[model samples]
Target: MVRVATLLLLRHGRTTANADGGLAGRQPVELDETGRAQATAVGERLRSVPLAAVVTSPLIRCRQTLDLALPQAEPVVAEGLIECGYGSWEGQPLKKLAKEPLWPVVQQHPSAAVFPEGESMAAMSARAVAAVRAWDARITAEHGPEAVWLACSHGDVIKAIVADALGVHLDLFQRIVVDPASVTAIRYTPLRPFLVRLNDTGGDLSGLVPPPRKRRRRAARTTDSDAAVGGGAGAAR
Candidate 1:
């Protein structure tokens, strides 16, 4: 069984559309002042970690977020990580969209929700999950299993990725909340992917780093991919 790299899913900060209560959906919406601040704050929190790679959605908002958050890193744009296509719904107010007949299906039955002349919610989840897993494997192979990477994406995309890691059904993904600028961490093993952190807005990230090579080798001998019997002692400080 091959060890996989840790994936850091970062939802882009709030955009102008978000502030105005509209759905940005694949629009070229940029970040607002508050969003820039959020990106800066998250950057400070991640400044110390040595990230092996940085990937981002092709959306402008996501690129803007990564610009402010990790300006020193070169992030690759992944089409699979882009926002879900909302078609005619793009740029519409959330309040107005909620009144549409399709809204209920989106909230309660996302697996079956397909936008008018746009992509299906299930399709979005599938592509996002596939992109993340493929990247994780590639990073692990190239940079070793201890590699840590980041992916800047939209809220729904991150939520879908998180749901997949948790083994939750796509229909129930609405229950997951991925706040703007929040970071979610997942570690994939041969057996399963572990959700280490979820919706973390302002948390110490030093704990996410793996132990030294010698210590890691020793720890590997004592533990498998299986979860701790009773939530075993957390990551090494």
Candidate 2:
């Protein structure tokens, strides 16, 4: 297996619902004008960097962000890298749903929350880890001893990926508050993953190195499929 040079994970740019404070899980919203600009800025800042591949979730917002952020490099859509399905909450307002007496219970026991008949955090976390692991494996195989990767995903999914990789408890999900367009860097040795940076969207890549050469790859398209996987063998999808 080959080793990766660096892995940069980016949350998608802002969306209409993001501006509206909507839950947006499985919402399939695209970037508004402002969001496009944000993505454009991110791409400009990262324009000089090289990425062997740009992996993204299959959501419209994620694809749009990658389109804007990696203007030159095309993205490859990976189902494992997609956002957590909110299930019954896909298009509903959480403010109203929280009215359920079990809302607190659901928050506390996300694994059993059921999202009012939807998926659970345990399930969401499983597939996300699988996706990252799959990507990590490919990074080793294709990029040689030193390859770089960029994943454009969602807040909940990325957090789950982080928590799982760092061995954090699944129940305490709020340990990290990932903002839109924030860039987080985590390094994985062949054995364990080492989080090199977190929430570094403020333009700090201090210990990070960009691609050694300016390169380009074919872009991947975005989709709005609403199906989801269980994410792993340990949890129910």
Candidate 3:
């Protein structure tokens, strides 16, 4: 039997940063009202699953998200699983950053790039990779089989986690779209990793992420705001 390593990635609930075009990375913000609902919904979705371990970022947002998702769940704090740090751009609006071409590069080469006053993409990738490998090793030694490693983290860190699991580059980040309170699952074998699922609402939990309710008008200026993380780069600094 292939050694299975299942990683359940959870994006935190919403906040003023997500809706207001601000960078909430490492700001210690809790789940907002809507964020609480989103978190609660996620909790309900994951309520019954037998989770081996819960890994989480230290940031309040992600911690809070995990708190709601796993009311009775206990998590290990992994600073490596923390969100990206945008440096000077921590609180800047994505619309404004769009003016700079480097913004696009950072988004595209996240595994190797970063904004000024922040950690580099390579560093992000390494830290995430280390954390995941550590989790896998510990779980393998602790649980004989049928154990799943569940991690509650921000979007970028989860993306990097996916990329590392698949042994790919940052470009893969484009293919993965994790929304707030969304869950992505990966089933891993001792030999390799396979994508069991991708960015999903409660629907993706069972491969039934419902279609969009309606054609929502999008902000022309913020095409990749949440998708493009402004924080969650380095360890808490």
Candidate 4:
């Protein structure tokens, strides 16, 4: 069987910094009350899916979100999935950061933006992409090609990963908005990776569920990795 895996990228629940319009960076920010509620809601959405592995960034916000969302699952903490080291920019208000010289660079050309005393946006993208792809390969190998896994991470990191998967440039990653607790799905095949979903916050995950085995067999004639012309019929209702 061809090896394939579905990766669910979940942005951690909201934090005080999110609500206050400040950058939390690598700080150990706890989820706010609303953030906790968001986690619970996403948990309910994911409760039906059988996941092969659950991974999370080392940040406290991510850990807390996963604890609430998938209480029964053990999550592996990945340093590569951690939030970008915002360095001196950590905890700074977005409004203030917007006025800084580097702010425009980060907005227009993130690939060239580097955090003072921290990491560069390009480096963050490279590591985050590598981490999730590695985890996906490992999960698919261990759990079979049908494996589905999740990785909980920070907003910018998730956005950057999505940008890479979509073949968009790191400079345009700012255009992608990954809301707190939103889930994006990507299915990887030998040929290419399909963006099955993007920034889904409504909690409707029915489409991710595999079809009945018999139906899946029939569908297998055409590779699921191939984008359906005319948008296809979408996931079977």
Candidate 5:
């Protein structure tokens, strides 16, 4: 049987930059008050899932979100899952950046757009996908084929990973929407990957839980007279 694993991609909760409408990029900004509540709510939403591992981006905002959402799990920092480096645009107002010519390319043709003094969208997608796949393999090997894992990362990073899982081109990745403190599930199998859920914030996930193992029924013991009858029938045959 092909081993299968489920990856729960969670976007970090709202941050100060998010509230201020600024691009946080890789800044060390922490989650805001409302973000804390959102984190707690999402944590409660996923309480039923038995996560094998909780992975997170190296960014402080993501780390904080992971801690708040899954307090018991020690988050494993995946450097490759960090947010896209916005470089010069870091901490800038989104409204101003929206007017720039490069912004259109970023939205429509992300495959060809490059952040000034930073990284390209394609590079970000490559690294994020690789990191997710690596963790999927590790979790499945360690926890079994039905293992479920959580990866707490940024919005753009999660979008990139989702785009790859859906086999969508990097240029079209902007069409995908990932909100703060949302959960998206992707199940990886040897044959093909399945997108179980996307941007789910208020849905019950009891269906995602693995079904209970079936109990094997023991064969009834045959009495001596019954065995003798069976032997006589066999001799007659």
Candidate 6:
């Protein structure tokens, strides 16, 4: 049987920049109080799942969320999963950026968009997807196909990964809404990838639990009379 691996993509909780509608970019921003509460709620929601590992972006916000949500699991910092650098636009307000000529391209045609003096959306998508695939393989190899792992990262990063899994073009990535501290899941199988859940903030995940193993039934032994009758019938035939 082909092995399957489950990946839980978690967006970090709200940050000061998030609340203020600023472009956090690759800035080292910490989670706000509301963000912390959200992270706690997410942690409580996922306490039942047997997470094999916790992977996260190297940024502080992502690290904070990982620490709050999956405190017990040692997080593996993945630089490739880091947020897209907005360059000169970093720490700027979204309202301000909305007036820029490139804003439309970013929202409508991300595949062709590039941040001023920063990375391109295509580059971001490629690296993020690569990082996720690598982690999925590593976790499945170490813990088996039934293993589930978490990846806590920025909103854009999570969206890119989800888009790749859904086979959506990067231009339509903006259409997918990923809220703060939301959880999305993708099941990677040999045949194809399945989007199990997306943007789920509250709900029971008991369904993700591995089903109980089925026991094999043994064949019943035949008595001496039954065996003699079977042999006589075979001889007559």
lDDT of 2 by residue, 1-237 (tens): 223556788988888888876778887788888888888877766764567778888989998898778867788888887777666766656787677775786567666655556677778889888887778777768875356678999998888877876778777766777778888877666556766667666673433653334333445221112112553232112
Quick one: best TM-score, which candidate? 1
lDDT by residue (tens digit), candidate 1, 125-180: 99999999999989988999878999999999988998998999988888989999
- Per-residue lDDT for 54-131 in model 6, tens only? 888999998888888888889989898899978888999999999999899998899998899999999999999999
Model 4: runs farther than 4 Å from truth? 1-3, 212-221
Candidate 5 or 3, higher lDDT: 5
82-106, model 4: which lDDT tens digit per residue? 9998899998999999999999999
Ranking by lDDT: 1, 4, 6, 5, 2, 3
| RMSD to truth, every model | 1.9, 11.7, 13.5, 2.1, 12.0, 11.8
lDDT of 1 at 209: 83
Error of 6 at 133 (Å): 0.7
Q: Model 1 off-target regions past 4 Å?
A: 215-224
Worst 10 residues of 4 by lDDT: 210-219
- The positional error of residue 236 in candidate 2, measured at the CA in angstroms, is 44
TM-score of 6: 0.88
| TM-scores for candidates 1 onward, in order | 0.95, 0.81, 0.80, 0.94, 0.88, 0.88
The top-ranked prediction according to lDDT is 1
Instruction: Name every residue pair that clashes in candidate 4.
Output: none
What TM-score does candidate 5 reach?
0.88
Off by more than 4 A, model 5: 212-237
**lDDT of each candidate versus the true structure:** 0.90, 0.72, 0.72, 0.88, 0.84, 0.85
**What is the TM-score ranking, best to worst?**
1, 4, 6, 5, 2, 3
TM-score of 4: 0.94
Report how far residue 127 has shifted in candidate 2, in Å.
Answer: 0.6
- Clashing pairs for model 6 are none
